[model samples]
Target chain A: MKLHEYQSKNIFSKYGIPIPKGRVATTAQEAKQIAEELGGRVVVKSQVLVGGRGKAGGVKLAKDAAEAEQLATQILSMEIKGLPVRKVLVDEASAIDQEIYFAITDDRASKKPVLIASAAGGVDIEEVAAKTPEKIIKAYIDPLLGLREYQARDVAVAIDLPRDYWKDFTKIAMGLWEVYKNTDASLAEINPLVITKDKKLIALDGKMMIDDNALFRQPDLAEMRDTDEDAPAEIEARKYGLSFIKLDGDIGCMVNGAGLAMTSMDVIKLFGGEPANFLDVGGGADSKKVAAAMRIILTDQNVKAVLFNIFGGITRCDEVARGILVAMDEVKPSVPMVVRLVGTNAEEGRKLLENANMITAETLADAAKKSVEAAKKGK
Target chain B: MSILVDKNTRLIVQGITGNEGLFHTTQMAAYGTNVVGGVTPGKGGEWVLDGKIPVFDSVKSAKDATDANATIIFVPARFAPDAMFEAADAGIPLIICITEGVVIHDMMRVRNYLDQKKVRLIGPNCPGLLTPGEAKVGIIPGDIAIPGNVGVVSRSGTLTYEVLYAMKNLGMGASTCVGIGGDPVNGTNFIDVLEMFEHDPKTEKVNMIGEIGGNEEEKAADFIAAKMTKPVASFIAGQTAPPGKRMGHAGAIIEGGAGTAADKIKALEAAGVKVAKHPEEIPTLL
Candidate 1:
C-alpha cells in the first residue's frame, strides 16, 4: 500500500530522520494554519500515489501562510494523473547545497535487501539509469548481519560525500534501512537528501510502500492504506478473499491458480481473444467464493464471455462445478461460459456441469475457442 | 519428469488445521501426493485428514517424522514468513508458500534467509505449483492441466489455467506448470523458473505469462535471449489498465515507467520471445 508523502515523513521523523516540519491539511484553512506555524516559506504538495506531481502542477512554493493557503486551495481542487488531491502537505522548504537520493528495497534476484544511493538526485532515477547508469550505486545487504557500517560507508563514498559527512551519511543510511525493515515497507525512499546551505543533511521528500501481506504485523502502518486511491473492484475482491485483477479485454477468466490465470489469458489471445480480468478463486474455493468472484467479474461491463478452467487436484472438480453452478445461480450471467474440467472427480464435475446449458470443452483450447466465439458473438 | 514435485515427494502442509489447508490437503492426498504430515503449532498430535497424515507442532518435528522434502503453506499472511523460514531451516528444499499478504519486508527477510540457506522458495502470495499428473502442490485447478510437453510459467494464476486450457484444446499438454506468485518480493522469479524450464527436456515449448511489475519480465527476456533453446510464447497483462494504477497483482503496479505491461512486452519481443498481444493468441503462437 502507498502512503502519502506527509504520512511517510511523519514516520521518518519518528525514526530520527531529519525532516522539515510538515502538516497534512484537507482544507485551505488547515494548510494556512500549518504554513503560519512553520513561520516561513512552505511547499504545498498534493497527496497522490502517482509521480510527476510537480509536472502536473500539484506542487507549488509559497512565500508565507496566505500564499500557502492559496496554493493548497489550488492543489486540493486540482487532479494530477487522474487522481484528485484529497489532502495537501504543507512543509517548510529547505535550501539545498546538493541533492542526493537514497532508498532501501527488496532485490528479488539476489534474494536480498538492496540499498540504492546516488549523488545525482531530485530527478527520475530511470532517467539516470538510462542516461548514466554508473552514477547509481547499489549495495546488497545481508539479512542476518543487517546493514553494516562498512556497507553504508561504501554507499556514502560512492555518492561522493565529503569525508566530514561520511559518518553522518552512514548513520542516515543505516537509519533509513532500519526504518524500512521496521515499517515492513516494500520501498522506503528519500529523494533529495539535501545538504542544506547551512551544511546540515536532511530528507526533503519521503515516500514509502508498505508490504500488504505484512500489514497484519503493523497495525499502525496498515491504517495508512488509502482505499480512496484503490480501484473499487479490487477493494471488493479483497473482502471476498479473491485475487482479482481487472483487465481490458472482453473475455472474463475464472481459474483457481495464478499461473493458470495468466496462461489462460495467453491462450485467449492465442485464439484472437482478450481477457477482461484475471480472477483466481484460490485453492478449494467453495460455491460462496465462486459467487463472489462472479459478482466481481460481472461488474466489468467489458466482459462478454466467462471461462471456467479447473484442474482439480487439491481442488475437487465436483466442488468447482458446484461453485460455478452456485455463482451462475447468484450472478445470473447474461454472458456465455465455457468450462474445462479435469483431474480427480473431474468426470463427476463435468457431469454436473453438463446438466447446465453452458458449453463444456474437453480441453482448454476448445474452451478458449468457445469462450472467444461467445465473446465475439456478444460483441 | 516434473520440475518440482512428483509422487515420491513427501509433503508437509503448514497451517493444516485452517479451513483452506484442510480442504486442499485432503484433495492433494486423494490425488496420490505423499502428504505425510502437517504443522499447526499446539494443534499437533492430531490427525487432520482421516488419520492418513500426522499433525505436528512445528516444521522441525514434521520433518523428523515424515522426512518431507517439500512444504505447501496455507497460513495467513501474518505468519507466512515465519512458516517459510521454519520450513527452510528444517531443510525443506522446495517451499511453496500459498499464503498471501505477507509484508514485502517480511518476505524480503524470508527470501534473504532462504537464499542464505540455499533453499528454494516459490511464493509468499502466489498460487503454488503443479507438476501436472505428478504431485500438485499449489492452489491451481488440476483438471485443466494434462501432462504433456509444454511447460507453463506465469505470474497470474488464473491466466495460467487459461493458457493450459488453450494448450489442451490445441492438443498441447503441459509437462509442468508453475505460478511464481504476483507479490513484488516473491521468493522465485520468472527467470529462475525459466532457467529450470530451459534444462527440462520434457518441455517442448514454453508459455510465459507475465504482468506489469518490477523488471523481472525484462530480466527473463534477457535470460531467454542468451540461453533458451525452446520456442517461447509470452503475454503481458494490464495493457488496458490506466497508467499509474495498481492493476490487480500487488506487484503488477505500473510505477515510474518501470513495471508497465507495454514496456515488458516490448522487452520480451525484442529478446526474441514470441509476444502475444491478447490472451487468446497464445495457442496459435505456440
Candidate 2:
C-alpha cells in the first residue's frame, strides 16, 4: 500500500507539516500549468512506489513552466523499475540551507515504531546505515503513550540540529509521527527535509506505505490504491479472495496453507524442481476458490506442472479433491498434477481424486517425486 | 507439547457476532479449542454462538469472567491493533489477530506496546495458528494436520496446509503448525517461532516456509545456523515473481535486491538448512 510522493505530501500538509506547493499531473499540459502556477523553478517527480526514481531520471528540476512540462513529458514516458510513470508531481523548488532526513517505520525485533532522523539527507539512507550507523539517530516510540516530546527532542538533538532549529525539528517530528499513526502507514518518510534560505523547515519529498488491513478504516486512503500499479494476476487474485504470489519456477503450486506452500516449494527444489508460483486457496475453500486459484496459476506460462497438496482439517479432503476436479475442468490444464490428500475423509478424497485419471501420491515424498517427474516431462 | 497453545488453553473470540468472526469461531470451537467466551462491544450479554461461554462487552470483562489466557481476534483491520492492545492490557498472554489490512504503523505501535507489556502477538494479516489434535486457531484446514513430531511454520495459510498435505503423504504429522501472518510489522516473527520449535522436544524436524519479503528468512537462517539443533528444511516462495509487484502477503515483495527467493535460499543454505526450490520438494528435504 505504498503512496506516491504527492499523496504523502498531501497527508503531510493536512498534519500541519509545511510542504512546497505542488500539484500532480498526468499530462504534459497539466504539468506545465502546475509549474506555471508554482512560478519560478519546479521539481518534477515520477509517481512510482519504488525508490531510486532520481537515478532512473524520474525526478528532474525545471527552471520554468515550459521546461517543467518537458521534464514531465520525459518522466511520464520513462519507466522506473518497470513501472511506467503515469503521473508526476510538479512542486515548487526550495533553496536549501541544510538537508535532513526523517522517517517513521516499524522495528520488528523491538516490536516498536521507530523514528529515524539523520543530518545527512538526500542520499540513500541504507548507504549511511552501512557506512556510518552512528550518523543515523533512531527513537522507538510507545504507541499508547505516543511520541513524547523528549523522544522527539532526542532525535532532533541526535541529528545535530542547532539549538534554534531544535524546536522546529521537534514540531516536525511530532507532526510526522501523528501522521504515521493516524494514517495507518507502514512507513512515512521525508527525505531532504530542507531548511530554506529563510531558515524555515519544509518537507521536500514524502513517501508513505499504508497498511492494507487498515484500509477498511480509512476509506479515503484505500481509494488511493492504484490497481494499475499492480500485476494483472494479483488484481484478479484479490478479486477472487485467493492469495497468489507468482514465482519464477517451472512448477506451479496450489496448496492449502502458507507454511505448507513454502515447504512444498522447498520440496520441489530439493527434488530438482523449481516452483512457478505460491498460491494459497485458504482453508474452507470451495470449488469456486479452487477454480479461481487454478486460473491465476495457469496464467503463469512458466508453470509446467501443478501440485495439489491438501491437508484437510476444517477443510475436508473430499472437498479439496472436488475443488481440484472442478478447477481442472475449468482450466483444462495441459500440465500434469500431483495431489497428496490427508486428514479427515482422506480416503474418500483420494477416491474422488483417483477417479479423475490424475496422478495421486500416497505420501508427500511420493507426491513430490511424481510432481517433479511430471514437471520434467512437461518441460 | 505445543509452544503457544494446547488443549488446555482457553480461547476468547474478539469481534464475535461479525460474519467471519462468528463463522470461524464456531468452527474453531468445534475443532476442540477451549473457546470459553466472545467479545463484541455492544452485543455483549447475548449468545451469538452455541457455546456456553459468555459474551462480554470488553476484553477486560471477558478476561475476568472466563479467565481466558488466549484470544483470537477476528476484528477488522482498522480496529485490530486496538483489539490486540486491549487483549494485551487484559493480560492475555497470547493474542492471535486474524484480521487483515491492519496498518503497519498501527501494528508497529501495537507490537511496541505488546513488547512493553511482554505479550505475544501472532498476526495482523495471517490465518492464525493450529496445534493438530489439540486446537485450531487460524484458517488452515484442521483435517490436514495430525499430532506428530514435525513443526510447520509459514507466512501463507493455504500454503502451510499444502505442506502439511505433502508431509501427511509421507506419513508425517505435525506437533504444531503456525502461520505467522504476512504483514511486515507482525507480532510473532519467523525467528521467534523457530526458537520455539528448536526448544520443543516434540518438534523433531521443522519445515520453515517463507515467502518473498523482508530479511525474515535470512534472519531465521542465521538463527537456524547458530541455534537450531533439529533438522531444518526451508522453502521460499515468489522466486519467479515479477519485479515491482506485491504478492498477496504485504511482506511478499522484492525490492532493491532484498526479499528475493534466491537471496533467502542462499541465506538458508548458508545456515545449513536444506533448501527446497518448489513446494513439493519439502517432503523430500525433510
Candidate 3:
C-alpha cells in the first residue's frame, strides 16, 4: 500500500525526522488557512500515489495566502497521472543549501533491507542510478542485527555528507529505520533530505509503501489504505479473500492460483482474446467465495465471456464446480462461459457443470480457443 | 531418487491441529509420506489421524521422539518464523513451510537464521516439493504427477499442476516438482532447486515455471548457462502485465522498469533455455 506524501510526512514527523511544517488540505480554503499559519510562503503538493506530480503541474509555489488558495483550487480540480488531487500538502517553504537522497527498501537479491543514499537528490533516484551510477551508495542491514550506528555513519560518509551533519544524519537515518521496521514498510524514502540555508536538515518529501502481507499485524497502517485508487470490483474481490486486478478486456478469468490466473490471461491474449480482469479464488475456496468472485467479474461491463480454469490440487475441482453452479444461480450471467476443470475429482466437477449451458474444454489450449471464440461471438 | 524427499524421508508437521495442517497432513500421509510426528504447542502428547501420527508440544520434543529429519509447517503467518526457528534449533536438516502471507521482515530474519544454521529451507508460502511415487510433502495433488525424468520447479501452486498435467499428457512425468512460493523473500529460490535437480540422476530435462518480479529468473538463467549441462525449458507468466501492478503475487511486480517478463524471457533465451510462449508449451519445449 502506497502512502501519500502528507501521510508519509506525518509518519516521519512521529519518528522525530524533521519535515517542513505542513498540514493536508482537502480544499482551497483549507490550503489558504494553512498558508496563512505558515507566514504565507508554502508549496502545495498534490497528494496522489503516482510519481512525477511536479511534471504534471500538481505541485506549485504560492507567495501568499491568496495565491496558495488559487494554486490549491487549480491542483484540487486537476488530475495527475489519472488520479484526481483529493488532498494537497501545504508545506512551509525552505531555502535549500543542498539536497541528498535517502531510502531503505528490501533488496530482493540479498533478501535483506538495504539503505540507499546519494549526494545527488530530489530528482528521480532511478534516473540518477541509471545515469551517474557512481553517485549512489548502499548498505545492507542485517535483519538479525539491524542498522548499526556505524553503518549509518558510513553511509553518511560515503554519500559525502559533511562531517558537521553526521550526528544529525545518523539520528535521522536511525529514526527512519525505526519507522520502517515499526510500520512494516517495504519502502521508506525521503527523496530530498535537504540541508537548509539555516543549516537545519529536514525531509522535503516522503514516500512509504507498507508490506501488504504484514498488514495483519499492523492494523493502524492497514486503515491508511486509500480506497479511491482501486476499482470498485477489485475492492469487492478483496473482501472475499480474493486477489483481483481489473484489466481492459472481454474474457473474465477465475483461477485458483496467482500464477495460473496470469497464465489464463496470457493464454487468452495468445488465442486472440483479451482478459477483462485477473481473479484468483485462492486454494480451497468455498462455494460462497466462488460466487463472490463470479459476481465481481460479471460487474465488469467489458466482460463478453467468462472462463473458469481449475487445475485443482488442494483446491478440489468438485468444490470449484459447486462454486460455479452457486454463482450461476445468483449472477445469472448472460455472457458466454467456458469451463475447464482438471485434476482431483475433475470428472465430478465437469459433470456438475454439464447442464449449466457453459462450454467445457478438456485442456487449457482447448479452453482458450473456445473462450476466445465465445467472446468473439458474444461481441 | 528425487532432489529433496524420497521414501526414506521422515517428516514432522507443525500446527498439526489447524484445519489446513490437519487436512494436508492426511493427504501427505495417504500419499505414503513418513509423517513421524506433529507439533501443536499445547496439543502435545495427543494423537491425530486415528492415532497414527503422534503430536508433540515443541519441535525439539517432536524431533527427539520421532527422529524426524524434515518438517513441513502449516502455521499461520504470524508464528511461522518462530516455527522455522524452532525447527532449525532442533537441528532439522530440511524445513518446508507451506504457510502463506508471512511478513517479509520475519522471512528475512528466518532466511538469515536458516543460512547460519546451514539448514535447507523451502517455501514459507509455497506448495511444498513432491518427489513423485516416493514422497508427497505439502499440498501438491498426488494423482496428477507420476514418476519420471523431468524435474519441475515453479513459483506457483496450481500453475505447477498445470505444467505437470500438460507434461503428463505428453507421456512425460516429473522426478520432483518444487513450488518456491511467490513471496518476495523466500527460503529456496529457482537456482537453489535447479542446482538440486541438475545433480539428481533421475532428472533429465528440467522444466522451469517463473513469473515477473525479482531477478531470480535472470540469475537462474546465468546459472544454467554457466553450470548446468542438462537441457532446460522455462515459461515466464505476466508477459502482458502492466507495470507497477502486483499481479496477485507479492513478488510478482514490475518496479522501476525492472523484473519484467520480457527481460526474464530475453535472458533465459540468451542462455539457451527454451522460453515457452504459453503454459501448455512448456512440456513441448522441454
Indicate which candidate wins on TM-score: 3
Candidate 3 local lDDT, B204-224, one digit each (tens): 989999999889999999999
Q: Mark the 10 consecutive residues where model 2 chain A has the least summed lDDT.
A: A257-266
**Per-residue alpha-carbon lDDT of candidate 3 for residues A234-306, written as tens digits (9 for 90 to 100):** 7888888899999989999999989999988899899899999888898778888998999999988899999
> Residues B1-286, candidate 2, lDDT per residue (tens digit)?
9778898899999987887788778778778988899999997889866546678999999999989999998886668878988999999999998776676667766776788899988887677888989998866667666789988988776566667776776788998888888777788888899999988988998998888878889999889888998999977776655666655566766766778888898999998899875655687887
C-alpha lDDT of candidate 1 relative to the true structure: 0.82
Candidate with top lDDT is: 3
What is the full ranking by TM-score, best candidate first? 3, 1, 2
Tens digit per residue, CA lDDT, model 1, B25-114? 887776677788999999989997778789999999999888999999998777787888899888899999887667666666777678
Q: How many backbone clashes does candidate 3 have?
A: 0
Residue-wise C-alpha lDDT for candidate 2, range A1-379, written one tens digit per residue: 7888989999999998999998999999999998988985999989998888998788998999999988888899998888888989999998889889899987665667889989988867779877999999899888668899999888887888888988888888889989988887878999989999998999999999877667767899988888777779988987877777777888888877555565566667767888888777765667788878888888899888888877764456787778778888877888888888776567898888777878887655567789899988986
DockQ of each: 0.39, 0.41, 0.79
lDDT of 1 by residue, A169-270 (tens): 887888888898888777899987999999999998888988766676789887778889768998899888788878789999988765466556767877
Model 3 chain B weakest lDDT span, ten residues long: B240-249
Better of 1 and 3 by TM-score: 3
Model 3 chain B TM at: 0.98
What interface-residue Cα RMSD does candidate 2 give after superposition? Answer: 4.2
